[model samples]
Target chain A: MTFRRDRVAALAVAALTAGLLAGCSDDEPDATPTGDGPSASATGTPSPSETAPVDRSREVVDGAAPLEEIGTTTGASGSSFRGATFTFYRLDASPTSTLLVWTMTGGGGSNPQDANYLSWELYPRMVVDDTEYRVLTYSRQGEDDTEVPGAVSNPVLRLTDGTESSPQSALFPPLPDDVDEVELKSPWFDNLTLPVSRPG
Target chain B: MRTAAATLAALALTATPTVAGATEAPPLPTVEDVPVLAQTWVGNVNDDRLAVLSVHGLRRIDGGTVLYYSMGTPQDALGDRATFSAYGNGNTYVFPQGTNTLCAAAAVDAEQGLAYGALAASTPTGCLSTGIVDFATTAEDPERAPVAHVVLAEVPDDVDVVDVFVASQLVQGVPVEDGPLEPTVEEAAPAVGTGWPSVDAAEVAEADDSRSVFDLQSRVKDLSEDVTTTQDGEQQELDLDASVLFATDEARLTSRARSVIADAAEQIEAAGTSGTITVTGHTDSNASDSYNLDLSQRRARAVGRALEQRLPDGITVRTEGKGEAEPIADNGTAEGRALNRRVTITLPS
Candidate 1:
C-alpha cells in the first residue's frame, strides 16, 4: 500500500509540472522577441513575411480618402459652457446646406448626460450677413421620411489625462456665395467668429 | 510521497503573482462639494428616505432654456434611491417671462442606460406623459452616494430666476445661472443614458404636430378625498368624485353633494369671466358603454343645474358626458377606477 501511494503522488506531481511548463511554452513566442533571448533572431526573421498576407484584410479600402475627408475650411477654436473647447477641423459647403466638422474636448469628470446636453439640446446657430440660420434636418441616406436633426453623434468622450476628444459634425442652412466670415452662437457663448474657406 | 506533494504545491504557488497588501479604496466625495445655485431637501415619510435636489444652472440651448439640476442623497442618509417621482410628477413647473408655466415633458437619469432613448423614439406620447429620474446605488461602489442629473427643456428665454413648486412647497426666487455647472472629478464617466425626447429637435417637431407645446401642463392638486383640481394658465378643471355625489347606478344627487357643488360654484364665480363653463362626466371601464353614457349625462346635468342656480346670471354652463373615455388614471386598479368616475367642471378662461 505504501509503494502504491508513492507512485500515485509522483504521477500527480509530474502532471502539474508538465501543465505549468505547457503554459509557459505557450507564452514564450510573444515574450522572446522583446527580451534578450538567443531565439529572438530565429523567430524575428519570418514574422513580417508571415504577417504580411494577414494584414491585407485589415488595410484601408481603395478610394477611402474621400470618405474620411471633412470640409475645406479649418483652423478655428473656441470655448463654450463648462470649460469645453471646440476645435473646428473642417467646413464643407454645398448649394443647399453647410456642414461644420469639429472636435469637442475638455469638460473632464462631467456626467455622461452632459454629452447629451451638448449634442441634442444645444443648437449652434451661424450668423451670415446679419441673418441667423438654424440647424437643418437631414434624412438618413436611402431612408425616406426618417429625418435626423443636426447634433453631436456620440454621448460621451471620456476626459482621460485631458486628451480625450469627441468628433462632431453639425449641418446648418446654406451660406450665401463668397461668404468670407460668420459668427457662431453656441450655447452660453454668443459669438465664435470663424473664417469660411469656399470650395475651389 | 509527502515530499513530492509538497514540491508540487510550492511550484503551483510560485506560478501565480503574489498579491500586494490589500488596501481600501478612497471614499467618494460628499454632496456638499457640488456647486449649487438652489437646493432643497425632501423626505419621504413612509419610507424614511431623504433626498437633496439642487438646481445647478440654466443654459440657452436650441432656442429653449435647458434647466440642469442634480438629485442626490446626503452622506450617511438612510435612503439611497432618489427619483423625480419622490417630488411627485407634474408638481414641478418653470415660469418664463411672458410664457405660461412649462411642464417638463420627461425627466431622464443616466443610470437607466441608452435603451430608454431608443425606446422613446418609437412611442413619443407615452414618453411625454411621465417624466421620471431614478437614481439607485451602484453595486460596484455602494459607498459612493448616488447622484443623478435632471434636466427640464423648453423653458423660455431671458428669465433670470423662477419659482419652483415641489412636494407642495413653493421655492421662490431660485437663481438661474447663465452657464452649466463646472464638471467635477468625481462625476467622471457617469453612466450613459438616453436624453428626453422633447430635447431632440426632430422629435420636438414631430410631437408638435400632434400636441402644441402650450398644451403640456400637468399641474394637478387633490384638495380632499372627493375633490381634485387641475390648472394651467388658460384653463382650470375641478373634479368631483361620483361616489360622493351620487348613489350606485343612479343619477340623483346625494344630500352632501349640494355643499360640494355650492363650494365649486363659489370658486367658479370668483375665477370665471363671462364665459361658458363645461361640466363633463366620466365613468370608469364598468357596465355597458350606452348605460354608462346615459348615467353620466344625467349626473352632469344634475351638477350643472345645481351650479346654475347658485351663480348669478351671466355665466353659461354646458354639460356633456364622456363615459369610459378620457380616463385620467389607469383602470387596472380599484383606486384608479374610482378616480376615473367623476364629474369635471372646467372654468373658462
Candidate 2:
C-alpha cells in the first residue's frame, strides 16, 4: 500500500525551515573505511573484511521498506500502545564535556499495516566533515537492569555540540564532529531530516 | 507374461516414501546422493526476504534418490533476501531453529571479520554449531552462487540449519599483492612454500617493498608504463598517463563522468586493499579563497557521491578540496590552469 509522501516531505521541510545543518573531503590522510577489508591471500576460507560489505548490504535491504514518500504528523503526538505514547524532542551540543543528550518518541501504537516484520536498530552514517569525533547509542527502556534489552524504541542519531561531545559505542562509530546535518531513515518514520533547532 | 511385466513396473513406482524422520538412518552415499544446503548471505534480524522460506540445510528420505542444498552473499540480497535453490526430492526437511546461528557465524568466520558475526543475534545452541553438511544438488543457475556444499557420509542429528540471511558485497577475495587492480587477476598463484615447479619462492622474496610477489608485480606495473626487470638490479620508469573530466565553468564531473568513474571502480575492486581511494580536488586562480574552497568542496563531494553510487561500498571513497593551495603546474598558463583545476585520485598502499 502507499504511504503519504507529503508527511515525509513535511518533516524535512520543517527541519530546513528550522535551520542550517551539515563531513570530510577525501583528501584527508585518515578518513577511509579501512582496517575493514580482510586479507586476500590467506586461504580459501572466507574472511571478515571480504564479507563485511556484503553483510552490510544485506542488513540495509532486509530492514528497508519500499522507497515511497509519506506524511507522519499524527504519530508524532499520539500513543503507541494504550498506555505509553510517543514524543519528539531536540538537543544542541558542543565538541567536548561529553554531556550529550538525545530524545526519541512517537505515538499511536506504531501499527503500520504494511510492516511484514518488526525490528529496532542503532544505524550510523557520517556527514564526512574533517573534525575528529565519536558517537554512542543505546536504549534507556530498562536502565535499572543492565542485562535486559531496553524497551526504548528505534532510530537514534546524536551529534556533538561545542561543549558536549558524542561518545563511542558499538552502534555509532567515530565520525567528523563538523557534521552539518544528520538524516536517519527506518520503517519507524517517513522522513528523518529533523534539525536540532526549532523553526523561527 | 507382458501383463505381469506391466504389473511389476507399477509396483516399482509405488515402492517408497518421499520423506524421512530426522532420526532415521541416512541413505547410502555411494548408491544414492543427498542434497546439501549452503549459505549465500547474512543480514539483520528483521529482513523479510530472509524470512521467505526455502529448502532447509539437511534432506533425507528413505528410498529417495534426490538431495538439495543452497548458498549466497549479502550483495545478492538486493531485496533483503537470498536463495537456497536445490533439486531432486524437494520434500520436507527439518530446520533446527537454533542452528541458524551457525550459518551466521560462518558468514563472520574469524578470518573474514566480526562484522559478519556481529549482524547475527545470538543463537540458542551457542556459536560453532555444526552447520548443514550434505551434497545433494547443485543450484540451477550459474548466477545463483555456489553453495558451500560438503557431502556427508551420514546426516548428523544436531545439524545446523541456517539460511543465508544477509548479503554484503561479493568482492573477489583475491589478495592485493596478487596483481594489478586496474587489470583483474585470476591466476591461482602458489602459496609460499608450496614448492611447485615454475613457482619460484625466491622470485617473491626478490620484491622486498611489496607484501608478496603478486603485489610487487602489480606495483611495478602501476609505477611504470612498460615495466621490465634486468639482472643489473636497476629499473627504468616509463610515461604513465590517465584522464579526468570537468564541466565547462566548474570542476564538477560532467555526464561523461560515469565512464571514468566506472573505470576507477574497476580499478579499486581489482586493487584489493588498494580499493581505498582518496580523491583530492583543486581549482583555478579565478575565484576568491573562500569561494574556491566551497567550489572545490562541491566538486570533491560530487566525485565522492558518484564513486559511492557507482562502486561497491567496500571501496572507501574519500574526497578533499585543496582549493588553489596546491597546483600541479603554474596557474598562469591556460593549459597549466586546466591541469591545476583537476581532481587527483590515489589508491591506498
Candidate 3:
C-alpha cells in the first residue's frame, strides 16, 4: 500500500514538473527549467495582481477512504441530561476509528439549559465485547516536544424556544472488525445495544 | 524561488492524493459560504509576507469546542509556510465556559505594558491541525494565488471565540461560527489538563495499539523573558536571570537587579500572601560543584533578603542553592548556561 502511494506521488510530481516547464518556457524570461530544480524567479517580488490564477479544485485520489460507515443503531436513540435531550443520530466506523454523531435539543421549561451550561468532560463511550472504548480527545505537540492533550471543540448552542437542536459528534478508537454488536454509553443516556452493519 | 521550489518539492511528496485511479478519496464537503466571525492579520500589514487568519466554523463536540479558520497569504508565489509556522507556534487563549475573563499565556519577549497583567494566567490547551487545500504557482495562473491553509483547533467547551497570539501579534475576538466543521482526523484526544476526566491509558493502548503515549505536563510561563515565572497550578516558580541580578560570579545584587527583584516582590505579593517563598539559586556547570554551590547559595540569599524586605508581613522567605545540579536547560551551550545561571523563587498556590 505504501509503495503504491509513493509511486502515485512520484508520477504526480513528474507530471506537475513537466507541466510547469512547458508553461514557463512560453513567456518567462527568468524561468530556468531544470527538471525539478528551483525556479529562478521565485525570489523576485512579483506583484500579487500579476501572479497566476489559483487552482481551487480538489482532485480525488485512491486508497484515501480507509474508513466507511459500517453500522448504526435503529430507532430513536437518545438520552436526557439536566434540561436537554441528546439524541444519537449516526455512527460511522472503520478498522481503527469510529465517528458518532448526535444532536442536543434544548429542554427549556421554567428552567432552561443549553450547550454552554453543560460540562465538556462528559464524553460518550462504546462498549464492545464488554470492553469500553472512550471518546478520543484532541491534542497537539507542545513545547519541548510534549504531547499536550485535552483540547475540545465546543460550538455555542443557544436555545431560544427549547426546541432548537445542535449537531454534535465524537471520534473514538475502532471496534473489532468482526464484532456484530456493541453497546453505547453516554453520560445522558442509558446503555443501548447497536447492531453492526456490513454493507457490500 | 527556492522557497517555492522547496514548497513544491514538499507538496510533491503528499500530492499523491491528487493522482487519478488511486482508491477513491472521501468526498470533501462543498465549500460553503460561511460568514467570517472574526479576522486578523499575522505579521505587519504592510509586509509582503503577511498572512490573514479568519474564523469560519465553530462547533461543540462531546467534551470540547472546535474552531476552523483559513490562514494563508493573499498574494501568489508567497507560500503558506510562514502562515502555517506562525499558527503552529502560536497559542490560543480561550475564555472557558462561564468566564468572561481571558487567561493569559506566558509569552517570550512579550510586549511591555500589555494588558496581560490584568487578566488571570493559566496554561491554555488546544490542538492545532492544518490542511493544505491548494498550492498554486504563478505559472499555473498569472495571478498565482494559492488556496488558504485550513486550520482547525479544538479548545475547551464554552470557547465561543479565541484570541490567537501568533508571530507576536494577538488577534482577539475571532468569533467562532456556530456550525458544523469536519475535523481532518478521525481520532483525537483531549488535552491533559482543563479538568477533563482521565482516560485509562492501558485500555486506550489496547484499543489503539499504534497510538503514541505522551507524558503530560503543564508549564505556564510569565510574559517576561529576563524574569520568567512558570506555574503548574500547585506551585509557581519565578526564575530571575542571575546575570541580570549579579555581576558574573558575584553574590551582591546590582543596581538594575534591585528593580528586577522589586518587580518580582510585587508579583509575589500580588500572587498571594502568607505563602512560604523558597528562593533557590542555580548555576551552570562552569566551575566546581562546591564553588558553584557557594556562589548559588550567596546569590539565593541576596535575592531572599531583598524579597523579605519588600514582601508584606507574615510571608516567610527561605533561600537555598542547587548549583548546577538542577539545570533547566542544556549547559553545553552559552545560551543554555545563561538560562541555568538563575535564582528561582517558588511559591505554592
Candidate 4:
C-alpha cells in the first residue's frame, strides 16, 4: 500500500511540472509584427488635397472679355479700410445690373458651416441688359446649396443687385438675364473663377 | 409534479413547429448583409440622464438566420456578460437579460441616425470623457466628423436606472452684441487730417457701408472742383454703419469674429488718445421700425457692457443703434447678410 501511494504522488508531481512548462511557453511574447502597417486598421486619415473652387472669374472662357480694361490699385491706402483695391470694366450696353466681386482675408480658421468666411471673402458683381442682380453665395456643401460633403474651401460669389425696393428685398430680384464672359483681376483674382451661363 | 411535467411537454411541442419553420429556409449572405459569428447585446436608453439598458442577445452566423439567445443574465446584472455584433453600418450590442430583438434594431437605427445626422460617431467604444467616439466607413475611412457619444454610470441599489442621463447635443457660440443688420452706404466727404471733418447738420445723412463711397474728387488732389463745394451752406454725410440687437434676438457673434473684436480693442488702445469709445449696434428689417430702433440701441449698450468687462481703464465706451431704415449690403446672400451683422467701435472719430 505505501509503495502504491508513493508511486501515485510521483506521477502527480510529474504532471504538474509538464503543465507549468506548457503555460510558460504559451505566454512568451509573439515574435511577428501584429499590426498591419498601413493596411491593418480600417480607420483612414483626412485626405490631403486642395478643395475645388467655384469658378467666378471671366477672362478664360468663350466670348470677349465682359468689360473694357480698367486700372488697378496696390499698397495700403491709409484709409480705415485699407489694403483695398479695385478694377474697372465697361459693359457694351448701359449696365442696369451690377455685381460686386470682392475678397476678404486675415480671419483665422472657419467653422464647418461657414468655411467661406474662414480666410477670405470673395464678393463679385455683374450687370446684364440693364437689370441689376445679386449672385447667391454659399460655401461648398453649405446651407445655400452647392453641397459638397467633405470640402473645405471659401466660395466666390457672383452678385446681381436685382431691384426689389427695400434693402431687405434687394436680394430677391429675378436672376440675371444672361451672363457674359467673366473677367479676371490679377494676383487677388488669380484662381477665383466662375463659369457664367445664362441665369436660371 | 405530474401536472408540471405535462405542461413542459406541451410547451416544447408548441415551440418545436416555430423553431422548425425558422430553419426551413436556408439563409443567404449578400453584399448588403453583414455576417456576424458571435452573440451580441444591444444597449440603449430612452432618456439621456439615466442608465442605459442592455437588451437581449442574438446568435449571428455566416449564412445563418439570426436567433435570439433566450438564456442571458438578469436585468439587474446586465454588465456581467455582454456581447455585441456588427451589422448594417454600426454595432448592435447584447444585454445580460433577454431583450426584444425589435427593440435592438430600433436602437441601432437611432444610434446611426444621430451619429450621422449632426456629423457624429457611429461606435460607442473607447469613449472620451466628453463621451464622443469616432467610427470608420465601409471603405475603412473615418467619417468627416466625430459622430457618437457613450457614457458609463454606476447606480446604487436604491437608485433608479432611468434617472441617469447624458447630453447628446453640442453647440459652439460666442457672445456677440446684436444680430446681423444691413449697413448704410453714402458718398465719402473730405476729412481733416486723419479724422473726419466737422459736419454741417443739414448735410449729415448716415448711410450703411454697403456702397463703398468712391469719389474721383477725393482721390485726385484738387484737380477738379473742390471735393465738397459749399452746396447750400452746409453739408455732412453721417455715413453711419449702425445696426440694432433685440433682447429676443440675442445675436451670437461667430467664434472667429469675436476674436477679431478683441484684436480691434487692442489696436484701438495702441492708436493712442484713449478715454471712452462708442460702440453701436443695429438690426435688420425683421421688426417694427420703432421697436427695432430701440432694440438696436439696447444692443449697442450691450456691446458697451461686453467691452467694459473686457477692456481696461483709459477707455469708456458708449453704445447705440439704428434699426431697419439704414442698410449697407443688400440682405440677400449669407455673406452680405453677415456683413450687415456687426458692432462698430468709434475711437474719437
Best by TM-score: 1
User: What are the per-residue Cα lDDT tens digits for candidate 3 across B1-349?
Assistant: 2222232233334443332112222333222222334343332211223334344334433322333334444342353233232222111221121111111121111111111111111111111121111222233332222222111222333434433333223333344333233211111211111011112212222231112121111222232435665432234578898988999989999988888888888888887757687999989889799999999999999999988999998799999988877755435435457767899988866
True contacts kept of each: 0.00, 0.01, 0.00, 0.00
lDDT of 1 by residue, B257-339 (tens): 99888878777777755778899998887888898888889999999998889987898899999887655543543544676
Candidate 2, residues A133-189, lDDT tens digits: the string is: 112211111123311111011111111121111111112222224443444333223
Error of 4 at B238 (Å): 16
- In angstroms, how far off is B70's CA in candidate 2? 74
TM-score for each candidate, following the candidate numbering: 0.38, 0.21, 0.37, 0.23
Of 1 and 4, the candidate ahead on lDDT is: 1
Number of clashes recorded per candidate: 1, 71, 39, 77
Candidate 3, Cα interface RMSD: 22.7
Interface RMSD of each: 29.8, 26.5, 22.7, 36.7
lDDT of 3 at B23: 26
TM-score ranking, high to low: 1, 3, 4, 2
User: All candidates' lDDT scores?
Assistant: 0.40, 0.26, 0.40, 0.24
True contacts kept of 4: 0.00
Segments in model 3 whose C-alpha atoms lie over 4 Å from true places: A1-200, B1-32, B37-54, B71-154, B158-160, B165-172, B176-179, B182-238, B252-263, B270-272, B288-294, B325-339
Q: Model 4 misses residue B28 by how many Å?
A: 83
